[model samples]
Target: MAADGPGKKKHGVLFDVDGTLIDSSYFHAMAWWQAFRREGLDIEMSAIHRRVGMGGDKLIQSLVPDCTEDMQEELKAGHSAVFSTFWPSLRTFDSVRDLLAACSDAGLAVGLASSAQERDLEVSRHLLDAASSIDAWTSSNDAKESKPAPDILEACLEKLGLGPEDVVFVGDAVWDVKAGAAIGVPVIALTCGGISEAELRDAGAAEVYDNPRHLLEHLESSMIGKLMTGSLDA
Candidate 1:
């Protein structure tokens, strides 16, 4: 909530919430499915799952592009309404708070670079309970486009007041890799979001992990860890 004033950290770490730090990917997909179902649209759950990390509008556009503009808005709102019902079911991944603390202690600005709604983000932050470790965060208000557009990542950069070279993004989706790549920020991909390691690498991820706990366990060897410690090689 406070600005990174004088003598603040130089390097930063941007993290995605859903499926990366939290275990809500499948729930999100189910919410989208229910929303589409209400419109008499029978979208496959697997299809919705593939677009879970991105915002609702982008997800609806990607999966149901044939719908009218008004229909798109309706579906998006429906998805939000449905997703809200499952907020109480949200849980943080193991060692999520530790990972944020590790970066913060290493003198890196910790940021949440998610396109989630503000209220949802607040819920996630409360779930993590690592406000002391966080330096900057983003909500849907900060970016219009979702993953693969680089807008969300760009907003995080602005929040941290750092350039792409000073940050390493951590996420669980290939769209995250693509967005980071678009802005020259290296990505550390996690496979717990239903994405394969090979697919993440193919999408330009510089490193990969199974989950937040795995990355935290191997912090010294991960790109984010190295970046935080000022040991990353040019």
Candidate 2:
């Protein structure tokens, strides 16, 4: 979901939904866990968490490199099956609403660029009650590839009618950073999704924050960093 409001419009901001803006990261891990179990594979939660931002196809392959392509599909299907059953339990992070509000209040267009399915993205919008603050959003369903590829971010930019120079992307995973870099958007790495600050930086994140609250606290400085620090925003 993207929120729209009347305000200044010099720039736009894109957000990653699962770990960056909401608390669904851990649930996604569990969903993947249940999905793998259904396929008779036992994997560690830590391993699953590390691959949380990857698309379903890559995710299954990352966990079980030896699995055949057909098995990968079955595993992905199983994971989705298990995850859908647990959707009712999902919740938004506490800082999400404030973060979006702050961005909009600061005269930035806010958008959601998540790798989650369209249905899951809708669930996030419903859970966060964030229909108004996000100006645009793009889901995995809208792209040919997911994170680590520029497709999702590209889709969001096209939908929002903004150039890469006019947007700043925020996310919680290394894949997010890679995707942002691939598209030439400056990325702010948020630690709320369980990725380390160093990892985010190495992945090409321009700045790293502990969570949305911290990012909001440093918005002017951080957002400015994105706008001018030798990237698309420049």
Candidate 3:
């Protein structure tokens, strides 16, 4: 990991890509479901949905604990192939670009702490059309572990030259909440990923919103705003 530069911002914000910025949670779940079917497993979509934010290896292991290493690799490949077919239909939530720009304009370094593959992150960035506002981003390859482990968040922080206390995370799943918590970063959870406000709150989210538009609408009062103004405590 790289060290912070003298001119680096004091505060930053990290965002999870799949369900938080892009509306692809269900697509991921379906792809996993298809992959499981190919391997003669019959897991429910609801179960898969709940695990969407985890890395592919972890997701496969969690869903199929008895799966061999070889089988896990195959399942992961199957999911990637299936998920690629849905790329064209993926869409970003309302005001995602504006929300990112708002954080950047507030002088907050914006980093994407996604557990997505490089190709998938590229597609999401293309759809967001707000690359100029992003100071840094992390793909699965950037970390040895994924969400619920804090590795990806740590990687993003390194990339942005920020610390956990200097930033907040925005995500759409319990795994994301857990990941942020592990690193002492407060998470602002969104229900746009199909998770409930109650579940997100229970999972340790600092605040809950309906989607990116809702957060953007309340930007001045949100955690991102607090971080920017140095009003939020470390």
The TM-score obtained by model 3 is 0.96
lDDT of each: 0.87, 0.80, 0.90
lDDT of 3 by residue, 1-234 (tens): 222331558898899999999999999999999999999999999999999999888898898999999999989899999999999999999899999998888888888888799998889989998877888888888999877899999998888878888899999999999999997999999999999999999999999999999999988898888887899977
Sorted by TM-score (best first), the order is 3, 1, 2
Clashes of each: 0, 6, 0
Which model scores highest in lDDT? 3
Query: Model 2: which ten-residue window has the lowest total lDDT?
Result: 224-233
Residues 1-234, candidate 2: write the lDDT tens digits.
344532446578888888887777888899889878887888999999999998988887777989998888888777777778878887776677987887766566777887788788888888878767877887777889766888989887777778788888889999999988987888889998999998899888989999888887886678643453423336
> 1 or 3: which has the higher TM-score?
3
lDDT of 1 by residue, 3-57 (tens): 4521467888899998999998998898889999999999999988988877677
Poorly placed runs, candidate 1 (over 4 Å) = 1-7
- Over 4 Å off, model 3: 1-7
